[model samples]
Structures are given as structure tokens and as C-alpha cells.
Target: MGKSQKKRQMRRHNPVRVPDSHLPKGLEAASSSSSRKEAILPILQKMESVDPAERKWACVAVSNLIQNDPSTRRLLQGKNAVGALINRLSDSEEEVVVEAAGSLRNLCIDGGFDICAEMYNKNILTPLKSFIPKISTTLSEYLENPKTAPENAQKLVYEFADNVITILWCLSETSNKAMNAINQISLVPFLMSFLASRERLPISTVTSAAQCLYVLTDENPPAIEEVRSNAPYSACVLSIVQSREGLPQANGKNKEVADNRGLALQVLCCGILRNVSPIPPPSVAATVDVDRDIVMPTLEPVLSLISLVEASQHAQEHIAKEDAIPALEKLSLKHTPKSDHKTPSGLELERLEHKLRTVQLALEILTGVCATLPEPDFDVQDADGEATDADGDEAHEDEDMDDEPEVDMAPDNEAAVKQQSGSNATIFQTLVAPLLTLIQPTPLSFPPLNGPSPHPPTTSALSAIHVSALECLNNIFLSFRGAKIDAPRADPDSGRRIWDSVWQALGAVGTDIDNPGQERRRATWEIGVGVLWGVAEAHVKVLMQLCDAATDEGVKVKCIGTLECLAQHPGSVDANRVCTYFSQRVPEPLLQAVSALIDIYSDETLPYDTNFRQGRFLDALVGSVEGVRKAVRGIDRKKERELRVRGEEVRDNLVAFIEYRRSLGV
Candidate 1:
């Protein structure tokens, strides 16, 4: 045969399987080889062809060719392939629609990700979802077709749903729009029917249903009734809670099923809990429930979820570990309203009690576990082998004492400054991008909240999951904790005041220092300290409060005892930096702190019954002034002069406050 004729014949007879690798070795010989479309077009056309049997192989070929590119999938942006797939959903051949629907799934890959920016405005998915019923009806038609094989037709519908999920998982804004699509197109009813059935059920239907619900709830507020996005979430949670039997897939039938049902419940509980907060969160317009409508009856679900997490505890979790301390660190912060009324229903109250017990129990467990972990040896070996060489001249403790090493002043090294640039990755994956996903409370305008987002849209729904993650990070940092505590540009006055406020909270009367579990103030103190340190400044007021607590006749001695301990922390040391910037802030806040302390003395004891500790704190503060004055000579002379004056004023104010408290008859 002529060379050209042989090539043409090869192309016609076996367009697709003709491996390009088999092209003649010479460049010129390959120059005339078939183009990409020339090879695949025939296969694609046949796959979409009306011919019954050829379409099967055609679908197979299409899947293979498009495996490497987005262009092939982009070709079906509208319903170009839908019409044929819908028709083929009823194809007399099982392999036909199976291949067709599977090939169609390739269309979802506009890019590597599940969502696409292009699909948003294109709005093609709306139509696709709209038309599914037509295809489903076609399946129904085939089921009853006397002339056709009904079993193959049934399989076709199921295949179509599966493919649809794969496709949706690849679409743009898949969660938001697909949710509306699921509801509008009646996928919910269909899924519920399957779940309700006793037969060998397709779990794909359930997973897809769950994904849709997750997406819906994630992007939009849930509907108010059982049909809302939360219905699926709640149902999924309930499913795990009630019927957590292992599925066929969990036993290795399918790769998608593992024991995420409990986790799924956890996710659902978070989403639900996030809907409300101690503080009102921002608004989210897309939710079915308005922010105001989103209410927590009490912390009951928080309690229940904690129990659930405990019930289905993973053997490797910190709580389950023998030595780990059970944590009370359920991230309990949420936006609270000004009013302090309890939720009307006992439901929320019960929940709070339950959660309280769960947290308390969890803390005990975690603490127990922590005690088991090996501690770093506390033995501090003598440096320079001084003990080993007893005759060696003792290294002068004063050596280079006058010349302190230069502190790193770079922004990154300073804890206070680092806050500006550090990446605060949260326990919640959602937190990395939009506030709606943040574990923190959504701002009033975030998600442009209405009333408030169904949940606070706040810190990724206070799940034990995220709390554990953050705590793990905390423990890690605490283990090898670096970074200098000293920092420039930190507002020492503000820091000092915050510190003093914290101290007052901790030292206040009726304070249950022994029972941290019940101490709301203690919880806040932990959070405040975490935050203050996290932000890299000491709370000034807390220091002053601590000092003032030392003033109480009863608590003065212990307060003095803790003065050294308080100084061990950032404490009023920050007042130095405040003097560096604003000369007045340090004294102003201290005066306030001293005054507050005097007020506490008027009561039975200091805030935390640390009244007897006050005298020691006052003595330390009085004694430290000269050393501080000496420390300030060259450091900040101009600011120090002002502070000295302010100190005198503060002392006078302290005396006045003392008289005022005495008059109050403490």
C-alpha cells in the first residue's frame, strides 16, 4: 500500500488505540501523524452517538482521553452533554449510561479544585439540578419499559446520582448553590427515603446527602424547620449517636467510609453551637435562621457533644492517653449580650450543667494523663563543671553582668510586635480565610451578619476537636517555648491595667480559687492571660490589683508572698515601656489599680480571699521604687521624671482610697 494510504487506513480503523508512541521513529515520518482531536473526536462522537452498544466503549475512551486536561471537561459547561446523558439514563444497555454519566463527571473539573470561579456567574449548575428530575423520570420510564431490561435502567439512575455528586463536588460554590439545588430538586426526600429503607442501600447517597447539607449549612444559614440545612446535620449527628453500626464499606467494601460518623456529629454540633454565643455574633444573610433567632437553650449541646466525644473516645486522643490531663479547655468564648438572664428553657441550663460536668471530667482525665507523661529532669547541673573541679576559681557571677547581651529588637522576635505579622492559624480550617469560618466570633458586619449568623460564624464552632488542636499547639510551644518576653512599642500602661484587672478578678472575694471549674472569673482569667501573653504584653492592672490585694490586713502577708511570683511574670515591668512612650499611662492606670485594691479591702477579704496577701505586695511595690528609679536613669530619663511625679500622685490617691475603704468599715 502507498505510505499515505496506509496512515489514513490506520487512522480510520483504530483512531484512539493507535498509540502515538507507535509513530514512525523519524521526525518527518511523524510530521504527518494524526492530530489530538483527529484521534479522539471519533471516539467522543461515538460515545455520544445514538447507537446503543458503541456508546459504552465511547464513554470509556472519553474518560481516558480527558484524564489529563480541563479543556475536555470545559466543553460541557451548559447542558451540551446533559441531554444525551439524560436520554441515556434510560438506555437499554447498563454500560451505556454508566459510561456516559461517568464521562460527564469529567465535566466538573474546570480546574483541579472542586469549586470554580467561572461557574459562579455562569449559573449552569442551577439548570443541571433543575433538569435532574427529567432524567429521574426517564429512569422511572425505563423501569416500567416492557421492551427494555429494567434492571439496567435502575442501575442507570443510581449511576447518574453518583456522577452528579462527583460533578457537584467539583463545581464552583458547590456548597451554597448545590444546597439550594438539592432542596429545590427534591434530592432530600429521595435521600431520606433511601436511608429509611431496609434494603442494601447505597451509602454514596448518604455521603452525598451529607456533603450537600454541610455545604448548605456552611454557606447559608439553615432553614428553620426539619427541612433546613441543619436537619441533615442534626440527622447525621443523631445517626451517629443512635445507629453507629459499621457500614459494609467500613469493613473495606468502599474506600470512602471510615468512622467519621461520630466526627460528622461533632462537626454538626459545632455548626449548631456556633450559631449562638455568650456574646451576640455578627449577622449572616444567607442563613435560614436569623442571628436573633439562633439561640442556645443552654450549654447542653456543648455538654452532650463533650460527652459524645468522650463516649466515642479515640484511644490515641489526649483524653484517652493514660498520663494526659483531661482538658476543661472547651473553647467556651462566644459573644454574650449585655443582659445576663438565663435562657428561658431548662434545656439550655441542663446543657450547661452537662457541659460543665463533661469539662470537669475531661479536665480530670487530661490532668491524669499529663501526670503520666515523662517530665524533663529538673536537676540543673552546675555549668563549667565547677563542682567537679572544686579548686577551679569560681566563675565570677558578676562577670559581664554590667554588659547585658543585646536583646533582639526585630519585629519578629518581639512577642508584642509579632502579633501584627504572625500567621494565626486556628483550630478550624474555615478560620484561615473568611471570618465565617474563623473559630473566633464573627464581627457584627462579618458575613454581613443579620441579627447574628445562625451561629456566631464565630470561632470554628467550639468543637473539642479545634480546642484539642489549639491546646496541642499550646503544649508544643510551651515545651520548647522560645521568643523573648521583652518587646518595644508595647503599650505598657494598657498592658499593666489589663493585668491588674485580671489580678482583681483572680483575687476578688468569693472567688473559688480552689474550684476553678465553677469559677467563671477563673475561666476568663485563663483566657485573658492566654490572650495577654499571646499578644505579648503583661496586664498592668492585674499587677496593681495583685499589689493592692497584698494591702488587705487579712491577705497582706500572702499577697506579699506572691509579689515575687507576680514579678516573675511580665507584671508591672511593662510600666517601663509605657514610660518609654506615654509617660502618663503608667501612673494613671496604677492609681486606678491602687484605688480598686483599697475598695477590695473594705470587703471581708480581697477578691479571691487574698486580702491577707496585700501588705506584702504593698511593701514590695514600695521597696521596688528605688530599684526601678535606679533602673530608669539612662533608660528613659524624661519619662521617669514624669513617672516619679505621677508616683507621688498615685501614692496620695492610694492613701485617699485607703481612708475611703476604712470608712466602709472593713
Candidate 2:
């Protein structure tokens, strides 16, 4: 054939060129070369075909392509594959519907919050609301007569239920409208049915249901009330948490995998329990059966998850380091390769990520408990009229020279001391210390270039953990009335250790603390002279630094609030002195911090999608700034006047915003 004819023939033999309209904007030029996305265009087109079998096949293909494949999910999403699959949910074919829902479910997992939000915006919930009752009815039929359908058909029904429930659950996480729709459909009881009959259902189906219920009940009053009112549902979730009966049976190597799955389910159940029940007051805690049976049991599994994740990371780091060493070095050390010392597989990494998420959720729940649990009513004063320490009265001779002498536990209050120790032990061991660990960064072993690197816990994930831990500690501090220690020579300390650790954990990001030689005064001071300053002085520096440097609004809010709290409530004589130190040492401390907060509160560029959330955050900033203004009164009278004037301006602006939002009925 002639060259021109051969070129035309080759063009015909070449893959059919996808139209520019099918590709995401700006990718039209690259479409001729057949991008990863264009490769899937035919499948997407087939999803819209008149043939039901082709549509079903296309949907299944999309599901399989996106399953555990985040990169492909993103490509497909950019190509409007999500919209196509969402449209397929309302397709005439049953198999098409199932495959479409399955694809959406995987997108929710692999694509995470952004895709879930996209799906919600595309009105996925409208179809999902319809699917909920249908799936529920299908499952009901299966439960009523399992043998009526062929076994494969029965499995399909379960798959459909699982996929739909999971998509609903994932969507509920992203938007309030989706959550309300889910609640309107009475999804809570349907979810509980799966958990109630977990053994009879596929583990995937049961786990998906449990996870959906977990999300629905968090801060969702209707769903919470539904679970609360149903004794069997409550008992079933609590039992799963306590016994881990939902964990699949496995032997040898598979046991570890089974345990991870079981523990994950347990964490979800614990989260569900946490949502439905409030922490009982200390007076009722000892007597409340629910507290004893459900709430207390939740902590162990959560703590175990934290420990497991940490242990796995350490093992991985060790293996990575050993493998990184030179062969000559290994020979010199007489090292032998460990058969099991392999890099974490994708599945293991996914499990680790899940465990970290569970840790964050668990910490948040504990934070709620800390915030709501009532203060102990016991009197600190003994017969002699001297107050006692709650954290114990052990004296440290090596304590900083500026430290106050430790008080002796009140003599004749042996019973109180015992009770106090028991409670303190539990809180510190289970909650406080773990929060501290999570707040600190996980260390990574340095891997050689061109060598396989260890998959360390991500900074963003660890940062999330840090924020959660900080919030929990904040609650602990607030709930306990700001850490009152009546012991002798206590040195006016408040969150000294916590602030120091947090500062280090943050790596002092967005700060100048890491400048050369600044490490000597990393947190506070040296042993002599200025070291005599109370912990309040040191903590003020850390909080102010963090407040100024933090980008996360939540972190900034916590720091600003904590600074104000410390200024208002001086814990000791040294703390009182250090409270004044904020005025004396830090130049216009409250002024800068409050001004930053006000700026954040009023920034139109960073406006929240909902006025309510904006207003609430602004309200928090207002309270915090006002407290700091009252306590520190700026660097001096002159600076104080400036702060007051600025505050007046902020107040006016805030009032106007509130009125505007109120007028709109938001």
C-alpha cells in the first residue's frame, strides 16, 4: 500500500480517538496519545450504552479498576466517571445498579473526602435514600427466607446491601444533608440488623454496616437516640466491643490479619457506644451499669490499637534500618537476614492507616468524656486544714532548683489517697500518657538513597493525632479546674511537660525556635538564674509561639484558649508570678495573639460554607481574646489601650456579621 494509505490504515487500526468532550479540560492535546484516563473512556461510554449487559459490564470494569486503586479513581473522577456511575445507580438493570453502587463505594474509600463530597454534590443521596429502604427490605426477605433465592443470588443481595449502606455511610460523613437523609430513612436499625446477625452475614457486609452506624451516630442525635432506645442494639454493639465476637476465626499467620480486622470492628463499636452514651458523672459512674459494662470496656481496645500501631511501626523501622546497612557492614556484624523482616505490604499499610484513624476517633471520644465528666466532690482539706495533692506527694531531690517542695499526703486521709491514686493511675496511664505519646511525633529510621525506604506514619496523620491529643488534654485541664495541686513547693506549674512535648512534637513548625544554638532554651530555661521561673512562664512562651505559628484553626484556637486560661487561673504562687510574667516578659502578648485571632475570625477570604460554623468559631475567638485581654492587659498601659481599642473594633465587626447572618436566617 502507498505510505498515505498505510498511515490511514494505521490510524484506523489505532485505538479509537476519544472526543475532546470526554476528557477533562486541558487534557484534549494529550488524549491523542491515550492517557490512562482515555484508556477507560470506552468503558465509561459503555456504561451509557443501550445494552443492559454492556452497561453492567462497564460498571463492573470501573469498580474493579478503582478498587484499592486511588490513582485510577482520581483519573476516572476527573473524566466524570463518578457521574456516570452515579447515573447508573438508577439504571434499569439490577446487576448494573449493584455494580454502580459498588464502584461508588470504592470511590468513597479510595477517593476519600473529596470524592465523597463530589458524589454528595451530584445528588448521590437522592438515589441512596431510595436504595436504603430497598436494600433493607431485600435483607429482611433474606433473613425471613434464606433458601428461597439461589445461594449466589443471596450473596448478590448481601453485596447490594453492603455497597449501598457503605456509600450512604461515606456520604453521611461529608454532608449534613446526606446524614439527615440517612436518618430519615431509619438507617440505624438496618445497620444494627447486620451487626445483630453478624455471624450469619458476610464479614464485609457486617463490617460495612457497623462502620456506617458508627458514622451516623456521631453527633447525630436521632441516630444516637435510636441506638440508645434499642436495648438489643446497644447490647450487641457493647458485646462486640467487649468480646470481639465479630472477629473472624483464623490460625497461624492469618490470625494476625483476623485480629486486625476484629480490633478495627471493635474500635467502630466502641465509637458507636461512645456516641450513644454520655460519660456519667463521677457520683453515678461507680453505680451505673452502662458505664461499667460499656464505656469502661471501650478504652482497653482503643489503647490496644494505639499500642499495636506503635509496635508495628517500631518493627518496621528496625527492619528498614537493618536492610539499609551496607553488605560489608552486615558481614562484619555477622548479621543474618530475617525471613519475616520484609517491608510492609499495601494491605499492612492500609491496616496501619485504619488503626491510626481509630486512634484519633477513640481519642476524640475520650476527650468528650473528659470534657463532660464531673469534678470529684471530695474535700482536699484534711482535719488539720491543709490541702493535699491528687497526683501524689512524691518528692524529687533532683527537681529543678526553682521547684517548690512536694507536700506530704494528708496523714489520716489514707483512704482518700488510695482512691485518688487509683483514679489518677487510670486516667494518666490510659488517657493522659497515651495522649502525650500521640502528640509526640513518631520517629523514622533514616533510609539510604536508592534503598527501600520505610513507610513511616504520615505527618498529616500524626498532626491529626497531635491535635486530638491536645484537645483531650485541654479538656482534662479544663474539666479538672486547671490542674490544682495543693502540694508544698509545687512551683506554680500548669501543663509544663505537655507544652514542652507539644512544642517538640510540632517540630516548632512555622517558627524560629530551631535557629542555631536556640536549642539550649528549646522550651524554657537552664538550671540556674532564669530557671527559677515558674512553669507558667515556660508554658506561656510555647502557647504564644504555637498560637502565632499554627495554621490549623483548631490548633490556633486551642493555643489561644489555653493561654487565656493560664493567665486567668494561676495554679500556684510561682504560677501567679509567671502569670504576671506574660505582661512583663512577652511584649504585647495578648495584643498580638488576640489580633491574630480576630483577623482569622473576620477574614472573608476564608469564610466558612455555613455561617453557623463561622459564627461559632468566631464566638470561641471572641471569648478567648476577651479573656486574654482581661488577664494580661497587654505589655503595658499603652499597649493595653491599643488592645482595648482594637477589641472594640473587632466587637463592632463581629456584631455586624452576626446581625447579617441572623437577617438571612442562617
Winner by TM-score: 2
lDDT of candidate 1 over 16-121, digit per residue (tens): 1111222234434433432333434465466566666566655554444443222333333222344444455456786665665566564343232322324433
Assess each prediction's global lDDT (C-alpha) against the native.
0.34, 0.53
Residue 613 miss distance in model 1 (angstroms):
33
Give the poorly placed runs of model 1, Cα more than 4 Å off. 1-43, 47-50, 66-95, 106-156, 166-183, 219-237, 246-666
In angstroms, the error of model 1 at 179 is 6.1
- TM-scores for every candidate against the unseen true structure: 0.34, 0.56
Determine which window of 10 residues in candidate 1 has minimal summed lDDT: 1-10
**Local error of candidate 1 at 474, Å?**
12
> What tens digits encode model 2's per-residue C-alpha lDDT throughout 553-665?
56765665565454433122222222322333222344444443333324332212122232243344434544554554433657567746766664555556545544543
| Most lDDT-accurate candidate | 2
Question: For candidate 2, what is the total of clashing residue pairs?
Answer: 3
lDDT score for residue 282 of model 1: 26
